[model samples]
Target chain A: MKKGTMTLTALLACVTLAGSALAFGLGDAIGGAAKVWEKKDAVVKAGKAIRKGTQDLTPSEEHFIGRSVAATILARYKRLNDPKRTDYVNRVGLYLTRFSDRPETFGGYHFLLLDAPNEVNAFAAPGGFIFVTSGLLAKVKSEEELAAVLAHEIAHVTLRHGLEAIKSSNLTSAFTIIGTEAVKEYSGSQLASLTEAFSGSIDDIVNKMVMSGYSQSQEFDADAEAMAIAFRAGYDPAGLTGFLTSLRDAAKGAPDTGFFKTHPPAGERLTKATSVAKQKKLTGAAAPARDKRFGGYKL
Target chain B: MNKSFWTVCGALLATAAVAWAASTVTVSVKQTSVRSDRQFFAPTVATAKYQDKLAVSGQKGDWYEVTVNGKKGYVHASAVGGGAGKKEGSSIFDDDSKEPGKEDVALAGKGFNPQVEKEYKSKNPKLDFAAVDAMEKITVSDAALATFASQGNLSPKGGN
Candidate 1:
């Protein structure tokens, strides 16, 4: 009887020891899993940080911003319904794009004719959307002059002038919000604030392009770039000077509005554009064939 | 423990591999000519169209030397995306009816994107998106551009 009791006690002791060992083994496995998850979490966090902290907006973001801006402008002016004329503008615009430093945007370059007969203005939105008022088109005497106008607008897009017009403080705040909200989803309030920042950014650009116009320096830079681009595209660089000369003549006849209000004095612009053309020795003449095509389409 | 360590190592290695493989660029424009030299006025050797994947064998300033269909030439860097056909970011405001979930919100936080545009559109319903859509549909073919350039006496002759 004493041996039997001793054997039973030994068996119970073995069972308790084995059970505790199994429990310890399970705990180790769980701990290992937790460590792996922690490492993965860290990696994801780092990835998010990198994405949020990026300084410049990506091509996709630029595209969306430009699209919204284009929509806003279209809201104000009716698009010209003449497909033939519109196609002509696009062809010239696309040809010049080949010579631009940045020829491609996310949505590609598009040219539209606005039916603002009295407004002699051309505007470029981000993402390569360009608009020229019919009044400006009518003022252009030759195809090369039209190319010059389109090239100027294209220069604005390539140089990101519209994006630069946004207030620095607004951009900083928006970027900060983006960086802080690193998670895949934002709360309701966070989204609301982001939307507000976006609206402010759009407002800044609109005010600059429409109400106030870009600074004198920016306009001059675009004019210089346009001359270079038009020269490269085999158009007469003097086309810009000719267009400005016409504007100067017209401004003398009528009150300053639209293009005159938005851009620097035509006299100053003509001098600058002519100097640039002369310095580059871009003396190419407008092709007769291009003029023929230009004449086929009635503005 | 060993399995987890291998998994983590594998994930890291994959990320590194992607960075290393970024030498390839895909044409993003509708079409662009690959020139014998970096300059736009240089002789043309071949032409690449949209989504045509090319290996970026070399780079000079803003131009990239690409190999397409066994032929090597220089293409402007602006004509192609830096990496393969990979696009960054996720769809944030793809569908306006549904409330965006966490994943969508995260992507939207990347920058001002389609989601923000949707919200802006909602507030300003008068904006003419239809006209914008029509404008986006307008595309000039490369052949037409080439013809125009040649007739207009632009550089890089059409045949070459």
Candidate 2:
């Protein structure tokens, strides 16, 4: 009897995941397959499925969630507001995004320089809202490193990493109402329910972004993706390795918030990046035009 | 059958076959660039707006070769929602094939959009959307970005 119930639970779980039908990359579903998100009160949930949990949210919905997350982050960290620097970063970041796995997002990619010079953190909200801290800018020795950093965050967005942070239970509520009918507007109760789910979605993401770090595997995945994206965009993969090497020493006096607190560099991550860097041929002239332009921007 | 009658039938069938072979796709995103090349940053040949029907052919990975208003170009498959005779294959990324009258209802401003943002903002006054608005304005033109990449010797690989 217990075996039959177990089989029944697995069947229903598969049915729920199949209902999501994400469009971009199906392979992600496999990696995320173990991530079967159950209803908040669902007692019989297990495994690690990725995009399926948040599959009900449209690209536009993802954008709104990201926009709010950006709002929250911007509220905490003010913009530096130097057009030249901001424009430069945007160009570089946007250019790298073209080479990332998922390039064209609903709202497209946008990058901003946060004013916190002491916090060496960067963030990539869903739907391509990227934030780079002045402190992170100060840390990079060259434009390649900057590209590497941006590429890492782009990987997060391209991989829908932020969306993955939405707790499955929250998704259960959001998915329950979306697309069930072709109504132009949700009824008041439905809207309220969705809004609560929306509010919780942001809470889950903000908590992950501000308090805890991504799973070490996710960080590693981002690092590996950063190398591929940077190399494709003609920046050397070494940039990531160089930055990771520097990050190892940063944990000593790391601040309470931002990259250091959330992303404590692991030795294994750096070693993996270093090996990958060695395999990728240095793609472009690093010193002359690139680093020279890097000098033009003020941290 | 007589030769002339047979010839007429062949002509009609040929024309029907041509029409049947032709596939159609509708742009599903707010906008998608029809590029000279399949590369995302390749030069934009044209822009397809939401619900714009396109004559399409060939598929290289996720991009569809499309002809828009006498111009030939390629659009990423994700940019278009449905193919000819394909109705059931829709994903969250797609808001495909709505009824004609209902098209306007789901048009660019549907789902969690500006209205939701406004509502959410009224409730949470401390969140700085004004900053996000200002941040969204930060943009680089294609010409400027191309120049930035070429000048810096950075944008060398995949981008056109």
Candidate 3:
């Protein structure tokens, strides 16, 4: 009877151990299923977010895009390599930046004079990179006029008009790919696709800035904002009107290239800028000393 | 064993919760003045240098209220990274140790950066990256700008 009882006890112990092992296996299976479900849910959510246009380009992304765009612009036009003139333009641009809405960006503000003669145009790339043609520089007679032009370009940078010029479809694809990738390092194909998207986006912006130009409304808005920025900076807001009027007059004599081609009609811009200046009651004037310094830089 | 696991998880969650309550931002510009108010014309209260870390306490429009060295001040959102001190992502079971996303990677200067620029240059040899490089080297000091403003009768001191 004692032997039988001991065997029975040993059998019960084995059964208990087996039962616990089965339960542990079941628990692990459930945990693994839950983990798979969680990962799937995250991916679905990320996809949905991309579909909803919730992804916005970060500042650093904008900086990179701007660098590429700037490179493209530089490819077309050589930079005017005058240290004195560059320094002067930078000083004027930097002073306006202090009073502008966005005083700083990821890469900081830079002003470059493009060596394009008889092309009255100014371009503002993303990340506070600005380009002014020598033609526009030669056209402005006073420091306030230069300030006004720089302020307009600065407004474009601050409002991200250049970035906005990128095609929406390109941005969506780029953002979607970026959002869906969980790993920092992309595979060979992934990097290829990303580079393709990036180049396409850059092309879109270049086309808008150099070829098609921004919309009428965007130019009008920049003009309006320029007036406000110049007023706040103590520069005569009428300087924008003065610059636009000069452009209109110059258009009659010169070929319709650069500014005349890329921007809206100067008469419309001048009218709008004039109205804004009047509404704001801007009465500042260009100091003679300021103009003297501006004149010191030779074209 | 399960009890200890849950305890550790709970502690981590609590720490993350606290960290979320007060976000931190790093200054990205060379030097940014912490204004006494949100507007640009407001008085300068303190100066924050590049890479200076500040604990964000509140926000008003484009400016963020931050504390550095036990002093309260406001810095424009553009002057710091993580624009306005916004937290990127958060979830109960989210793994913070995972590799960063594209946005974070770009901000950290990892992917699609100088390396990519070099690659792009190799492909498009006509692009004038040397001029862009020179353009990037230009720097303007605050003192110089102030003097320029004063000389030109511009804003802040020119009595706009």
Candidate 4:
């Protein structure tokens, strides 16, 4: 195998092993150890190709992807039926999308407000699809902070992180099992599990495949991208660091829960994000007094 | 390998994705005037014609052609849930619901729920509730708020 493929294979192995250790018994790891590294190159190659294709997708193509991901997510948590929150999220998402590198003139980014007020999470997918919970929105102090979150999700789509991971893997079997709909259904943690099983070892490649995340470096890149997007949209870049710091602080005492457990530790992410913000001169940016008009949402 | 192959596969995948994505109902709104002097309107309203359940339509107007027990007549937008499609970029009704109605003077002294009232008081928490409640208790006439109100669906939430 080529040197790059070998290295990726080892990384994939570690990620899969880590997830396996978390979910299954240590005994199973010994049994499935040999099979992990096989076909590693093909999977990585496929992931790279998919990422490239997804990135190259046109505005309409991206929107189509967004709609699928958004629908699947909305269907899973059917309890939050508030249209006011839904409409508000969509309006804000669309507004942010207007400032993205690629804006959809035909069909702008559509948002679905998940009524899962307790789910402290939000996401953006290809094709301008986005979502946020009332729970997450409730914690946001300003519109700029909210915009910062949206911009980060937007960066994921622009970077084609999910598609790239899928492309690089020999996903014929997995695709058949989960399908694209499954991608929407699987939470970040669940994706992390899958990555461990597929990746021979664990590292960046496994991180991308299972958890649908970029590495620490990749995440920092995304943060920088988010800052630029927010700044360009006339929002303060400090919003990115503010929200990231809040997430880091919130994760400190909480149980090992949700996506944070799968990717890099929140503290490191927060530090890197702050450094990136400082490097970009975001610290000097003024906080604009703005209110998000989600008045009817009762927390 | 060629353009045709790529186009064909792309279209197929896109169509499949679109089909899977479009589960939610699409509602549209139209504006109409009401005859009542205490004319009221919600921020938005969505109504389905009595028989045509599949073809649901939304209207953000001062008066909506609402069907109550199959009897069609104009109802105050505020009486029903108000402002369905109008809140998005498009406003079908030119009339602003913010304009006061006759005899429906704003109430003084905020007591409806200090917390909710405080947050949403600017939207005129002082409703002519005597007149509005006389017509109907604080009901969500707008689609978004109605959506919020209907979360538990069985309970009534007081305050903004």
True contacts kept of each: 0.30, 0.31, 0.26, 0.00
Candidate scoring better on DockQ of 3 and 4: 3
How accurately is candidate 2 docked according to DockQ?
0.17
**Model 1: chain B TM-score vs. truth?**
0.46
Better of 2 and 3 by TM-score: 2
On a 0 to 100 scale, what is the lDDT of residue A131 in model 2? 95
Instruction: Single out the weakest 10-residue window by summed lDDT for candidate 1 chain A.
Output: A21-30
Q: What's model 3's lDDT at B1?
A: 26
Q: Which one wins by TM-score: 1 or 3? A: 3
Q: Candidate 1: where is the Cα deviation over 4 Å?
A: A1-55, A183-187, B1-55, B67-75, B79-109, B156-160
Estimate every model's Cα lDDT from 0 to 1: 0.70, 0.68, 0.69, 0.42
Chain A only: list TM-scores of all candidates: 0.81, 0.79, 0.81, 0.61
Give the winner by lDDT.
Answer: 1
B36-86 per-residue lDDT for model 2 (tens digits): 987765788899886687775545565677798888999875456321111
Task: Tell me the chain A TM-score of model 1.
Answer: 0.81
Off by over 4 Å in 3: A1-55, B1-23, B26-53, B57-62, B69-73, B81-112, B157-160
1 or 3, greater by DockQ: 3
Per-candidate TM-scores read 0.73, 0.77, 0.75, 0.43
Candidate 4 local lDDT, B32-124, one digit each (tens): 222222222233233432112121022323333433334344433322221111112222222222111100111110111122222222333
* DockQ scores of the candidates: 0.16, 0.17, 0.17, 0.01
User: Which residues of candidate 4, in runs, are more than 4 Å off?
Assistant: A1-63, A105-107, A169-212, A283-289, A292-298, B1-160
Best by DockQ: 3
- Ranked candidates (DockQ, high to low): 3, 2, 1, 4
